[model samples]
Target: MAVVVALGAFLMTLFGGWVAQRVIDRRHLVLGLAGGLMLGVVGLDLLPEALSAAGDDLFGVPEALLLFVGGFLFAHAVERLLAVRRAAHGAADWGAEPGGPAKGKERVPQVGLTAAAAMVGHSLMDGIALGAAFQVGGGMGATVALAVITHDFADGFNTYTITSLYGNDRRKALGMLVADALAPLVGAASTLLFTLPEELLGGYLGFFGGVLLYLAAAEILPEAHHDHPALSTLLCTVAGVGFIWCVVGISGG
Candidate 1:
């Protein structure tokens, strides 16, 4: 049952990805919406949890550092991959060349690999959220499950849109759709692993928070800045954060 719900949640995320693809021409808008949504989630949700999870202990300092660094490193690796792709294409191939698709397929695999790896943490975070949902009693658990499904739809749309735009891979975009569709199932199956010591729960959640934070700051948000008016992006970002805050309050967390 949990697996079914988890799968449904991930599929919703993929559906978001599919929908995101339609607005490919306006990549900036896609990134702006996705980045704003992700950043808002981080501001209203992930950052606070990360701070609280660190607590007032000396040992936890390192864990917090680990969480931040892990996310940062993930971003760095992705950036490096992008850089390498650009270098291989001689700076001209990245949408500037007059070659007109004559030589762009060489790095498609790397593009896909980098994309999958960079976005991979989202899967684990979904699993952790699932693990968290199991706590709200059976009825609340069901509601939580439904909520996961709902948000994942947005998440999928964002990821699909960004990855497809960046990697320029239609197949990979579809693959993202498929993968995210299956992610909730994987998350549901992961409950077996997530059922852990209560003391360790905060650390787990913090890590997930870090992943979300990294996605917002590194992938989606930066893309929002690309080829768009700064003022427009800034306003969208604020609105997103404000909206998320309102929703978070409604969620009572």
Candidate 2:
């Protein structure tokens, strides 16, 4: 039953990806909205849940918060390392070439792929949470599933946008989108065999949240305004955040 309900998330994700593909021409708007959605998910959804689940402290701070900082630093370090390696290997001509495409922005395809992969992992966790909720009761399961399905649309949108933003091919972006869509189902099914530890899940969520926040604040938002400094893009970002807020409110989270 849990797995069956996850089909809703799968379909919603595909629809979201389709919407992103349709507006491929408005690159700035897409990044702006994606940045907002990522920020909302990290702040309003993931962090609160992580705090509740991983209620441990290290020194004077919560473990989840500590992991959150670690996650941010880790993402930054990885990006820098990748950039350095590419430069050393003579592959770092990341800026626009003369007389090339008009939107010749710097892109790091690997970073995009990594971020999308993290989204997929988070979706898988969502499915696991769905199945676990059902184990408690149908009402709980339904509530959790509703939250997962709604936010998953945003997840799909951000996944595709990030993948494309980093210079990955359309085919690769679509492939990642598909993987993300299917993750919930696989995660739900896996729960039939075993349940995950809550503390571990919380820690993972905290870390992933940091990575996502870094992408939004450092990468996506700046890129959105780099070329086309428009007010509509900023509005789209605010709308994106509001959308998630509405979803969380409706879900009683």
Candidate 3:
């Protein structure tokens, strides 16, 4: 199961990253589309399960709380680490000089690092969702994968673009590409370790859900709204939700 998941995630990451490169240059369309898809993932996949988890006694409430917290802390830590790493890298690159030689200096990618870290965390959470889905039923597990892949694809598309915009170097872009590619495999490999305390897992899940929600509302959606009219941007937003609605309806997810 782990190997299959690893391979699947890697392949998906590669595909998503590569396709992202093509659309990175398309700013408005990409942001709009990315925003919508993100909303869909949250509404169609994560929310339903999280809401259901609230009612299911076998999973336990404490466990659910832990999952949210764990995921949130993990994401927060990764973001902080990446931010620190970026600052250090920049300071080092500057080397106490005015307009130091930059071309050969190899300006490293802070955003790419964050993107890779974020996605790995994302994939690990998805792996849990996948495992949890199977606990319910085979059909539900497959359904979760379908929804997750949709999310992952959009995630790859946007991260690749955002990282590329920050990096401004094909080599840096490639690093983002490869790093994004590995995140899911890392997540898949960690599946064996899911036996940690239930509350712990619950905290992570809830926290991660919050991370996704915050990202969608605070970061991704606002970016989409900037300089664009609210209503026009909203149409795309609804379109994204509508697309997911259609997918869920068709797939019975």
Tell me each candidate's TM-score. 0.68, 0.62, 0.61
Residue pairs clashing in model 2 are none
Off by over 4 Å in 1: 1-8, 50-56, 59-62, 78-93, 100-114, 117-121, 133-173, 192-194
> At residue 85, what lDDT does model 1 achieve?
31
Task: Give the total clashing residue pairs for model 1.
Answer: 11
RMSD of each: 5.0, 5.9, 6.5
lDDT of 1 at 97: 71
Q: Best to worst by TM-score, what's the order?
A: 1, 2, 3
Regarding TM-score, does 1 or 2 come out ahead? 1
Name the regions of candidate 3 deviating beyond 4 angstroms.
1-12, 24-27, 54-115, 138-143, 158-169, 189-205, 227-233, 246-253
**Deviation of model 3 at 188, angstroms:** 3.1
Q: Local distance difference test, per candidate?
A: 0.57, 0.74, 0.57
Query: In model 3, what lDDT does residue 221 have?
Result: 67
Model 2 vs. true fold: TM: 0.62
Residues 1-253, candidate 3, lDDT per residue (tens digit)?
6436546656666677788666533444445655676567566755555545553444455444455556556656765766533432353345456667663255456655565556556666666665555444454455455545555665565556556544556776566666665665566556656554443333444554666655566555665565454576777777877876776677566
